[model samples]
Target: MEIDFAEYQLSSQLRGHEDDARGICVCDNTGIATSSRDRTIRFWTLDESNKRDYTLSKILLGHTSFVGPLAWVQPNDEFPEGGIVSGGMDTLVLVWNLVTGEKIQTLKGHKLQVTGIALDGSDIVSTSVDCTLRRWRKGQQVEEWEAHKAAIQAIIRLPSGELVTGSSDMTLKLWKGKSCIQTFLGHTDTIRGLAVMPGLGILSASHDGSIRLWTLSGELLMEMVGHTSIVYSVDAHSSGLIVSSSEDCFAKIWKDGVCVQSIEHPGCVWDAKFLENGDIVTACSDGIVRIWTTCHDKVADAVELDSFASQLSQYKCSRKRVGGLKLEDLPGLEALQIAGTSEGQTKVVREGDNGVAYSWNMSEQKWDKIGEVVDGPDDNMKHPVLDGVQYDYVFDVDIGDGQPIRKLPCNRSDNPYDVADKWLIKENLPLSFREQIVEFILQNTGQKNFTPDPSFRDPYTGSSAYIPGAPSKSSGVSKPTYKHIPKGPLCRLDVTSGVSPFQRLLGERHSFSFSAECNRHDFSVLCVLVRRNSSDWSASSGFDVIPVTGELT
Candidate 1:
């Protein structure tokens, strides 16, 4: 399917615990971790479709205190298999193997409650309420740093062998080991979170509802003000994107100090991070994590809630505002696609093959249509094909910029005349080419049983590309991974406005190359042959394919 990135949709929700949730982490593998005020941790797998796609993967006991912070140990270039590391008010940091639910070695040294933890390689760092920071090496207590005079809320390691800590004392401190290197004091309230951009120094969030950019030498570089409420969590992306979750119940993204996107929730946002694809993932107090993409020329240019603006730098500018609206009950809404009729009605398309199209009236009431394309022929005939399709050359021609498209020679599946093929055309093919393309698809595609469902639309890209495997029920699989597509000749149509969805299947979706000629208004269909069941191509090792040298009608 050709996904339209113009809108966002809600995926499956991870539900189990019932108390106010604090932190959420969508693991690189496995499932998601949700921590609640109920003093419990719940894991939701993607592969199950039950009342709650979650199980008590591990009910981390031993914390005499409520869980305050959680972080998933991502697979490093050093270690592909990852684990989970969590911290609680008990002042303890525990590492657990996600696969086997086995607790790794525990390091104990913090006198007060542990607030947060950060891990890199075999080195681990923790901040605590006792106003101290400790670093632990693989199998030993490496060092401790008394860098803060008050409770240390957050800490981040910089590339310059320095560590930056944010504290409730309204200041950010840079540290080396047991010694403080520099102190940045500017925020009017408590410093809540800190994020480092590697070579770009550090960014800190504060209860003053602003973020400050501080140099490692204690110099204040830039002050960002937008959050209407206290900023609790701050995460920095390598692509100059900084995300902050606040009590304002929103997660905002800033690009070099200018607010770009804001995602709102029903509850306070506790944590947010920019994914590898420039998308933001935020955890809210409502027991949900939201995912938002960065689309240009959209509502992404809006400034964050400017509750307290006096301390902000002059670089803050208000630009055009576009999207970023809160859709209720959809916590982790990530990917969005929009499709509609040529009338340009104000209707949003949600994912699913429901065989129906719903539009909202002025009052936002659903006005349902039988399907996306409704007014066509009945179960029998008596319909019109929007695209110009010749019955005989139906499957051979792809809707193009113009008509009279040519066809190429290709081998069809073995069972070309199977009953399935006949049923597919009768149901899927437009009345104009029902009989013709039905025969052509059978002749060339080699699928004798190829029957087009009235509800079936050929996939937009690639060939032999089947749907991905669903999540396993017990394995707690949550994310969908891309499947391999075999090399093959694929066909596509570039129908102009008012064209039908199923113009015809003239060629394969994936191929090596092709050329065509047609007029501006004349839609020409194009097709290419693909190698069947080809192996996947890799960066180090490419694959050979059976290249089709000719064209198709």
Candidate 2:
């Protein structure tokens, strides 16, 4: 098979996930499903009345943590529409009924994040960061083994019924049940993705920024090298096109082991897969799933096509204030010629079109580069004043049952979970109501990213903080009184944060994240969705509390 088009263009942008979109499963041409760090899976189907348009069909909410890999099973007697196998950071592999959006079974055993998933006939095969692979038959664990010494990150079933797994050990093993038939070694770093190349051999993507093709007998075939950062995923299309996503913020299309097209994203491209029609679907860190098509008629319309360009221009034109200073008015390199009045003094200098921050080093007698300056959200806008203090929002929360309304103060940049936790602690409310309150805040504020922590304290209750997945003492978990079992200490979440609203959370604590994402406007998108950028905003200090049942959901 061969590709007929010379170039590809943006077809559509699917937006719904509240956090990073992590995995994508294309169900032939029927539909597409994606999992996210937001702890949910969304199914999208083509709107046939409108070509190339996909509409959300269902939302699966079972994973308690970041959902990773997804495998699609064609329609069978067991599942009339189809079936889906999903693995998540919660260490659970779930089988789902695609039509009703219900969990068919929960297969558990892995003690860590479940990374890769594949279907073995009627059974489910899963690999985990815990360094093990397990097979589930009819919802029961039938086989389990350590597939690698390091974390097993990728897995795929071959046509012959044997399984292949890639791992952080930098090796891929061809397995027949518990036996390792052959070991293919070429990746110099962690293997992140694996795909079956139809009648050809196997394909693997790695953290070494390369994609490798390997024969079944442990022989290397072709090495595709173009990605400058970690390649997160790879998929083979029937057209012999290989699509790969990377931390470099690109989804690259390859033909005959050569780079053909590079699609740039606003954030890290986590996963990319091929549709049966040769279109590409990519999951990105910006919490968006975008489609790319070579069909010119299917390309995105003008408004959608200019979105990124519009955002870039808006950032550049509104550079009056960057990190609390008028960055556009900053001095040039000549400002660095004079000695600083004090040690460790910081200064911003204009270098071409960028404002670079530098700090004075008295001992070294030279300025050290700090970082590039970025723009702020809105300088003229007024924040709500509460008790002589300013805040982005002050929400009114009613916990039901005739409870008096309490104030929930928040900044646009504040994590809703954090604010809700602290307000619950202060109001002496049930810590279990934390998620509900967070949802309320998100809905009212039009914000999305809601990263929750593992544990939170009630403070008033004086009980040990309960972890999300741990069996709580209140649940009447049986205690054997074996003191030697060594239960881990309760995690005490610190609610205090005095950092600037302009500052950003380090990317997964990654040491070498892309510098482009640090742009002032880009980082500010975390607080508010920038796609529909708005400035006609006001800070209201009050909210109307809505009544609700005391359900945990």
Q: Which candidate has the top score in lDDT?
A: 2
- Compared with the true structure, all predictions reach lDDT values of 0.54, 0.76
Top model number, TM-score:
2
**What TM-score do all the candidates reach, one by one?**
0.48, 0.61
lDDT of 1 at 219: 80
Off by over 4 Å in 1: 1-12, 24-34, 42-64, 74-80, 138-140, 294-553
lDDT of 1 at 154: 83
Model 2, span 1-553: residue lDDT tens: 5645478898999989999999999887669999999999999999888787789999999999999999998998988899888999999999899878999899989999999998888888999999999989999999999889999999999999999999999999999988999999888999999998877889999999999998899888899999999999999987889999999888999998888899878778999998888889999987989999988989989998899556435445344454544444567788778776558767777676676778889988888888987656654424432332235676555444555656677877766656765675466443444545655666666664443333543333333333334354555533222112112211122222332222233111212222232322223222232211223333563332312222231
Residues forming the 10-long window of minimal summed lDDT in candidate 2: 482-491
Badly placed stretches (over 4 Å) of model 2 are 1-5, 311-353, 356-553
What's model 1's overall lDDT? 0.54
| Candidate 1 structure quality by residue, lDDT tens digits, 22-131 | 76665754666766666666555544543222344665545565666776777765335566677776667877666566567677888887877766556888889998
Q: Looking at candidate 1, what is the lDDT of residue 487?
A: 21
For residue 542, give model 1's deviation from the true position in Å. 94
